[model samples]
Target: MASDRGHGITHCDDPRAAQLSGLLTRRRQTLGLTVEQAARATGLAEHRYTALERGAGHGIDLGGLKRVAGGLGLTGQPRETFLLLAADPDVTPYDLVERRRPSIEELAHIDLMEPNPALITDHAWNVLAANASVARLFGDPGRAADGDRNLVLWLLTDGAGRRFADVDEVRADAVARVRAALAQIPADATLQALAGRIAADPLGAGLWRSRSPRLPAEASARRLRHPLYGEASVLVTTSRLPGGLQLIVHHAAHLIQSPAPR
Candidate 1:
């Protein structure tokens, strides 16, 4: 038998709570207003503001926090804090606000094709979901490992780069895919962070600003030197899915032809 008493509570760890509380108090104090004055300005009662500053178990609302932020003249992304507060059931007033965060399974789907390497990436370019062919082609079906392994990273720095007979083409494909994903997630923090990190790398930075239209999907055979498959010319097909969860699926264009070593 197991207890579900603490099932959904997050950020309950004392240090985090204390840290957030301290931030709240400092922000308020920085405004040079007493608790009562701050509460009056923010349309909250003094006690409520005090409890939030103390990080007491009282639930906080996103709108209320936005008001507080407005009153204190704080700027930058407040959505992160809003989401954190929304995750705490005890601190949230809106039921919809407290719904569980979305999972990758819920965000994107995949389909495998035999004898071809294929996979789909979410708007953040995180390999949210991949298919069997992708694993077989990459020689590791489990390489994606959820959303942690960035495909761009593998193409840029890992041994995966050795498989491309035409490194330029692969780099072009990577940039095209990244640009497509960026179009779908222009303001996503996770994607922005990734773009920033990639931009720091000279090779990656060069492609970051490429304005080239997407490469045509007309079946074209390109040499690929797979660690396991030796050298082969693999035809590639790339398809983009529009809206919500932006996805791009890539598959071998010539699954039946035998490729010669480059």
Candidate 2:
């Protein structure tokens, strides 16, 4: 009789295993490829490919993963995400955020951004830090209630709708980002709770279920409404920091577009 591990494929119970399996299955289906075709494309035996899709295969190293990624036609960020998921299943972006902090020097650099609205957020979209401009523009995350400090939560449930002209577009983008992050860290309780809360809203629930593409890091221009400054078109850019933190900056296209409040 086979051992329990061999018979039951205990590893398949792991969260990462399930994540990989789902990703592979979704990609294959999206490409309209049958299992045999995908197996042939990956240069793997049909049985081996099936086992991989079931999250039961073992001993697939880096080269094999590369072959799989290439066969699936995953390029750019998608390919990189695939490789990282396969190679470091246990790595959690939140852990990186928890273990590191911005140096005073880094904070100084952020301060140099000055009038531009800039803030740092962790994988779960928790606002870790923000400059004065960000505080002035978006309402200081530091002063928000615990639940509202999460950008996604704020966008979906709190007052973000009042701050952006294209609130629907912004909400959709936030949902997509959260979906991608949840796939990478399925075991995170905080993320799971966040997803539940987002799904509680009718519009958010629809967005969560819809298949929307993840927006690029540098988003197109969006109109921001400030109580004192009125409305201005802003371009948002995001840069990855050393420790799973993101530096998001909003550059106004034409600052002071509207007259000041009386």
Candidate 3:
């Protein structure tokens, strides 16, 4: 009787739908799973799974999306990103990136944090602005070579040499964050290239492939061997800012007393 598409299945033409479809297909292929295998893993019928991969299953519910994410072995922020895209295929992290430049008010706030190392970063963790304290603690990002001002990049590459006492732990966490961010904005060419560079490094590649828990934004104590200030202890905290930016602060930092040499 009805001729639109037989069983009332409507084709979704949304660009986001296409993006989601591509992600699903790529992820399945990356895992070396066949369509049937993916369907089984997702607990969905073969045809339904295929439809989703074709961007034709826009009507899938949240429960269905959750099953898909779980079936794909996605965890932490990556899982959250998958569900978010499923809910609204049109979401883009670019809006936040577009507004990345810190406002005068934000700059003033950073200034107020004086004496405590503070910096602002965009969604991709590019160092947008930093206070004088941050420059003093970590070398000035402004002077970094083009495309080298990213927080994660610095952590993965320069952190250990810079005397970060918890370099391994910090590097792993940074890699996890990058992985999640990549999933959220799969279409970003810049981020894709950055990920490639990170994967090119042996340690970074190992950490990227390994599973790690997502760290919360709770304050954590960190030890740094400051070239000038000597060994120091600081409490690091991160907070979300407007426009998909992050405010990271190193608070209450003081030089650590070294035991008298024998």
RMSD value for candidate 3: 13.6
- Global fold similarity of model 1 (TM-score): 0.46
Give the 10-residue window scoring lowest on summed lDDT in candidate 1: 1-10
Off by over 4 Å in 1: 1-112, 139-147, 180-185, 209-221, 241-262
Candidate 3 to truth, TM = 0.58
- Which digits, one per residue and each the tens of the lDDT, describe model 1 over residues 170-207? 77667666666555545556667777767887878887
TM-score per candidate, chains pooled? 0.46, 0.59, 0.58
Q: Candidate 3 at 108: error in angstroms?
A: 1.8
- How far residue 221's Cα lies from its native spot in candidate 3, in Å, is 2.6
Compared with the true structure, all predictions reach lDDT values of 0.56, 0.73, 0.73
lDDT (10s digit) by residue, model 2, range 19-108: 666677778888888888899999998878777776654667766877888899987667665666666455443432333566687688
In model 2, which regions exceed 4 Å deviation?
Answer: 1-98, 213-216, 256-262
